[model samples]
Target: MCLQIRDIKSKVIYCSAVLLAVMLGLGTRAYGDQLPHFVSVHFGDAIWAGMIYLAFRVLLTRHPLWLSLVLSLCFSFGIEFSQLYQADWIIHVRSTTAGGLVLGQGFLWIDLVRYTAGILFCYVIDQILQY
Candidate 1:
Protein backbone atom coordinates (compact mmCIF):
# COMPACT_ATOMS: atom_id res chain seq x y z
CA MET A 1 0.00 0.00 0.00
CA CYS A 2 2.82 2.42 0.78
CA LEU A 3 4.57 1.58 -2.46
CA GLN A 4 1.34 2.01 -4.38
CA ILE A 5 0.87 5.49 -2.94
CA ARG A 6 4.39 6.43 -3.93
CA ASP A 7 3.81 5.15 -7.43
CA ILE A 8 0.62 7.14 -7.75
CA LYS A 9 2.33 10.30 -6.54
CA SER A 10 5.12 9.81 -9.05
CA LYS A 11 2.63 9.39 -11.86
CA VAL A 12 0.75 12.52 -10.80
CA ILE A 13 3.92 14.56 -10.67
CA TYR A 14 4.99 13.31 -14.08
CA CYS A 15 1.62 14.22 -15.55
CA SER A 16 1.78 17.68 -14.05
CA ALA A 17 5.24 18.19 -15.54
CA VAL A 18 3.97 17.15 -18.95
CA LEU A 19 1.07 19.60 -18.69
CA LEU A 20 3.42 22.42 -17.75
CA ALA A 21 5.69 21.56 -20.68
CA VAL A 22 2.73 21.73 -23.08
CA MET A 23 1.75 25.12 -21.74
CA LEU A 24 5.32 26.36 -22.03
CA GLY A 25 5.60 25.15 -25.61
CA LEU A 26 2.34 26.78 -26.60
CA GLY A 27 3.37 30.06 -24.94
CA THR A 28 6.76 29.96 -26.66
CA ARG A 29 5.27 29.38 -30.10
CA ALA A 30 2.49 31.94 -29.69
CA TYR A 31 4.80 34.71 -28.56
CA GLY A 32 5.93 37.48 -30.97
CA ASP A 33 3.67 36.28 -33.79
CA GLN A 34 0.24 35.86 -32.22
CA LEU A 35 0.79 37.89 -29.04
CA PRO A 36 1.84 41.49 -28.51
CA HIS A 37 5.53 42.23 -28.11
CA PHE A 38 5.53 43.14 -24.42
CA VAL A 39 3.14 40.40 -23.37
CA SER A 40 4.93 37.78 -25.38
CA VAL A 41 8.35 38.64 -24.01
CA HIS A 42 7.45 38.85 -20.33
CA PHE A 43 4.90 36.05 -20.33
CA GLY A 44 7.36 33.77 -22.04
CA ASP A 45 9.86 34.44 -19.28
CA ALA A 46 7.19 33.70 -16.69
CA ILE A 47 6.40 30.40 -18.36
CA TRP A 48 10.08 29.56 -18.37
CA ALA A 49 10.19 30.18 -14.64
CA GLY A 50 7.15 28.01 -14.15
CA MET A 51 8.85 25.26 -16.13
CA ILE A 52 11.85 25.53 -13.84
CA TYR A 53 9.63 25.19 -10.80
CA LEU A 54 7.85 22.20 -12.28
CA ALA A 55 11.20 20.60 -13.03
CA PHE A 56 12.25 20.93 -9.41
CA ARG A 57 8.98 19.43 -8.29
CA VAL A 58 9.39 16.51 -10.65
CA LEU A 59 12.91 15.76 -9.51
CA LEU A 60 12.54 16.47 -5.81
CA THR A 61 9.05 15.37 -5.08
CA ARG A 62 9.57 15.36 -1.34
CA HIS A 63 10.88 18.93 -1.22
CA PRO A 64 8.81 21.66 0.39
CA LEU A 65 7.16 24.31 -1.77
CA TRP A 66 9.40 27.09 -0.49
CA LEU A 67 12.51 25.08 -1.26
CA SER A 68 11.22 24.30 -4.74
CA LEU A 69 10.46 27.96 -5.43
CA VAL A 70 13.87 29.12 -4.23
CA LEU A 71 15.72 26.49 -6.22
CA SER A 72 13.70 27.33 -9.33
CA LEU A 73 14.43 31.04 -8.97
CA CYS A 74 18.10 30.36 -8.47
CA PHE A 75 18.19 28.18 -11.55
CA SER A 76 16.26 30.65 -13.71
CA PHE A 77 18.49 33.50 -12.56
CA GLY A 78 21.57 31.42 -13.20
CA ILE A 79 20.49 30.77 -16.76
CA GLU A 80 19.71 34.44 -17.30
CA PHE A 81 23.09 35.44 -15.89
CA SER A 82 24.80 32.83 -18.04
CA GLN A 83 23.65 34.74 -21.11
CA LEU A 84 26.12 37.48 -20.15
CA TYR A 85 29.01 35.14 -20.89
CA GLN A 86 29.96 35.05 -24.60
CA ALA A 87 32.39 32.16 -24.89
CA ASP A 88 32.67 30.61 -28.34
CA TRP A 89 31.26 27.19 -27.44
CA ILE A 90 28.39 28.67 -25.39
CA ILE A 91 27.65 31.11 -28.21
CA HIS A 92 27.60 28.27 -30.72
CA VAL A 93 25.18 26.35 -28.51
CA ARG A 94 22.98 29.41 -28.00
CA SER A 95 22.77 29.76 -31.76
CA THR A 96 20.70 26.59 -31.97
CA THR A 97 16.91 26.66 -31.39
CA ALA A 98 17.08 24.43 -28.30
CA GLY A 99 19.96 26.38 -26.82
CA GLY A 100 18.28 29.68 -27.56
CA LEU A 101 15.24 28.57 -25.66
CA VAL A 102 17.19 27.13 -22.74
CA LEU A 103 20.18 29.53 -22.51
CA GLY A 104 18.61 32.63 -24.04
CA GLN A 105 20.28 35.03 -26.54
CA GLY A 106 21.05 37.92 -24.21
CA PHE A 107 20.74 39.10 -20.64
CA LEU A 108 18.10 41.55 -19.44
CA TRP A 109 17.23 42.89 -15.99
CA ILE A 110 13.57 42.72 -16.91
CA ASP A 111 13.91 38.97 -17.27
CA LEU A 112 14.65 38.69 -13.58
CA VAL A 113 11.43 40.54 -12.83
CA ARG A 114 9.52 38.28 -15.19
CA TYR A 115 10.99 35.19 -13.58
CA THR A 116 9.92 36.40 -10.15
CA ALA A 117 6.43 37.00 -11.43
CA GLY A 118 6.31 33.55 -12.97
CA ILE A 119 7.54 31.79 -9.85
CA LEU A 120 5.10 33.74 -7.73
CA PHE A 121 2.33 32.76 -10.08
CA CYS A 122 3.24 29.11 -9.73
CA TYR A 123 3.41 29.40 -5.94
CA VAL A 124 -0.04 30.92 -5.81
CA ILE A 125 -1.42 28.21 -8.05
CA ASP A 126 0.18 25.52 -5.90
CA GLN A 127 -1.31 27.01 -2.77
CA ILE A 128 -4.74 27.22 -4.31
CA LEU A 129 -4.64 23.61 -5.43
CA GLN A 130 -3.54 22.45 -2.00
CA TYR A 131 -6.82 23.67 -0.54
Candidate 2:
Protein backbone atom coordinates (compact mmCIF):
# COMPACT_ATOMS: atom_id res chain seq x y z
CA MET A 1 0.00 0.00 0.00
CA CYS A 2 1.14 3.51 -0.79
CA LEU A 3 1.11 6.23 1.83
CA GLN A 4 -0.16 9.72 0.99
CA ILE A 5 2.81 12.12 0.64
CA ARG A 6 0.80 15.31 1.01
CA ASP A 7 0.36 14.77 4.73
CA ILE A 8 4.11 14.94 5.33
CA LYS A 9 5.45 17.49 2.84
CA SER A 10 6.14 20.98 4.11
CA LYS A 11 5.50 23.93 1.84
CA VAL A 12 8.65 25.71 3.01
CA ILE A 13 10.83 22.78 2.06
CA TYR A 14 9.15 22.43 -1.33
CA CYS A 15 9.49 26.17 -1.94
CA SER A 16 13.16 26.00 -1.03
CA ALA A 17 13.61 23.09 -3.40
CA VAL A 18 12.00 25.13 -6.14
CA LEU A 19 14.43 27.98 -5.60
CA LEU A 20 17.46 25.70 -5.51
CA ALA A 21 16.39 23.92 -8.68
CA VAL A 22 15.91 27.24 -10.43
CA MET A 23 19.35 28.45 -9.48
CA LEU A 24 20.98 25.19 -10.52
CA GLY A 25 19.03 25.04 -13.78
CA LEU A 26 19.94 28.60 -14.68
CA GLY A 27 23.49 28.05 -13.56
CA THR A 28 23.73 24.97 -15.74
CA ARG A 29 22.80 27.10 -18.72
CA ALA A 30 24.89 30.08 -17.76
CA TYR A 31 28.08 28.20 -17.02
CA GLY A 32 27.53 25.39 -19.46
CA ASP A 33 30.71 26.26 -21.27
CA GLN A 34 32.72 25.52 -18.18
CA LEU A 35 30.95 22.23 -17.46
CA PRO A 36 31.49 18.81 -18.92
CA HIS A 37 29.54 18.44 -22.16
CA PHE A 38 27.46 15.57 -20.78
CA VAL A 39 26.39 17.53 -17.74
CA SER A 40 25.86 20.76 -19.67
CA VAL A 41 23.67 19.00 -22.17
CA HIS A 42 21.72 16.89 -19.71
CA PHE A 43 21.48 18.50 -16.29
CA GLY A 44 19.78 21.68 -17.49
CA ASP A 45 16.65 19.97 -18.69
CA ALA A 46 16.68 17.58 -15.74
CA ILE A 47 16.89 20.41 -13.25
CA TRP A 48 14.11 22.25 -15.06
CA ALA A 49 11.87 19.22 -14.74
CA GLY A 50 12.86 18.80 -11.13
CA MET A 51 12.04 22.45 -10.50
CA ILE A 52 8.63 21.94 -12.08
CA TYR A 53 8.04 19.05 -9.72
CA LEU A 54 8.93 21.20 -6.75
CA ALA A 55 6.79 24.06 -8.03
CA PHE A 56 3.88 21.67 -8.38
CA ARG A 57 4.54 20.44 -4.87
CA VAL A 58 4.52 23.97 -3.52
CA LEU A 59 1.35 24.92 -5.38
CA LEU A 60 -0.49 21.64 -5.02
CA THR A 61 0.23 21.14 -1.34
CA ARG A 62 -2.99 19.25 -0.69
CA HIS A 63 -2.53 16.90 -3.63
CA PRO A 64 -0.82 13.54 -3.50
CA LEU A 65 2.83 13.45 -4.54
CA TRP A 66 1.99 11.11 -7.40
CA LEU A 67 -0.46 13.67 -8.72
CA SER A 68 2.23 16.33 -8.65
CA LEU A 69 4.62 14.01 -10.48
CA VAL A 70 2.02 13.20 -13.16
CA LEU A 71 1.16 16.84 -13.67
CA SER A 72 4.82 17.80 -13.80
CA LEU A 73 5.50 15.14 -16.42
CA CYS A 74 2.49 16.27 -18.42
CA PHE A 75 3.46 19.91 -18.17
CA SER A 76 7.07 19.25 -19.10
CA PHE A 77 6.11 16.98 -21.99
CA GLY A 78 3.49 19.47 -23.19
CA ILE A 79 6.07 22.24 -23.32
CA GLU A 80 8.52 20.02 -25.19
CA PHE A 81 5.87 18.97 -27.74
CA SER A 82 4.79 22.57 -28.14
CA GLN A 83 8.15 23.21 -29.75
CA LEU A 84 6.88 21.36 -32.80
CA TYR A 85 4.51 24.19 -33.53
CA GLN A 86 6.38 26.85 -35.49
CA ALA A 87 3.92 29.68 -35.50
CA ASP A 88 5.34 33.15 -36.09
CA TRP A 89 4.33 34.49 -32.65
CA ILE A 90 5.52 31.45 -30.82
CA ILE A 91 8.69 31.33 -32.87
CA HIS A 92 9.30 34.94 -32.03
CA VAL A 93 8.61 34.24 -28.39
CA ARG A 94 11.11 31.39 -28.47
CA SER A 95 13.70 33.68 -29.97
CA THR A 96 13.98 36.01 -27.00
CA THR A 97 16.12 35.26 -23.93
CA ALA A 98 13.24 34.59 -21.56
CA GLY A 99 11.21 32.85 -24.23
CA GLY A 100 14.10 30.69 -25.34
CA LEU A 101 14.74 29.65 -21.77
CA VAL A 102 11.08 28.98 -20.97
CA LEU A 103 10.04 27.63 -24.40
CA GLY A 104 12.90 25.71 -25.89
CA GLN A 105 13.54 26.38 -29.56
CA GLY A 106 13.83 22.76 -30.57
CA PHE A 107 12.35 19.46 -29.52
CA LEU A 108 14.43 16.39 -28.83
CA TRP A 109 13.23 12.92 -27.82
CA ILE A 110 15.99 12.79 -25.23
CA ASP A 111 14.32 15.63 -23.30
CA LEU A 112 11.41 13.36 -22.47
CA VAL A 113 13.88 11.00 -20.86
CA ARG A 114 15.57 13.81 -18.98
CA TYR A 115 12.25 15.04 -17.65
CA THR A 116 11.22 11.59 -16.50
CA ALA A 117 14.52 10.98 -14.77
CA GLY A 118 14.55 14.37 -13.12
CA ILE A 119 10.97 14.17 -11.90
CA LEU A 120 11.48 10.67 -10.59
CA PHE A 121 14.67 11.75 -8.82
CA CYS A 122 12.82 14.60 -7.14
CA TYR A 123 9.92 12.35 -6.27
CA VAL A 124 12.35 10.07 -4.50
CA ILE A 125 13.89 13.04 -2.72
CA ASP A 126 10.46 14.16 -1.59
CA GLN A 127 9.69 10.71 -0.32
CA ILE A 128 12.93 10.56 1.62
CA LEU A 129 12.31 14.01 3.04
CA GLN A 130 9.11 12.77 4.62
CA TYR A 131 11.10 11.00 7.35
Best by lDDT: 2
lDDT of 1: 0.81
lDDT (tens digit, per residue) of candidate 2 on 2-91: 235543446777888889998999999999999999999999999999999999998888778999999999999999999999999999
lDDT string for model 1 (13-97, tens) is 7567658665865667666677777776678878778878877777766667788889999999999999999999999999998
RMSD of each: 2.2, 4.1
Please identify model 2 stretches exceeding 4 Å from their true place: 1-9
Q: After superposition, how far is residue 56 of candidate 2 from its true place, in Å?
A: 0.4
lDDT of each: 0.81, 0.91
When summed lDDT is taken over every stretch of 10 residues in candidate 1, the lowest stretch is 13-22
lDDT of 2 at 69: 95
Q: Residue 127 lDDT in model 2?
A: 83
What's the distance in Å from true for residue 61, model 2?
1.4
Cα-lDDT of candidate 2: 0.91
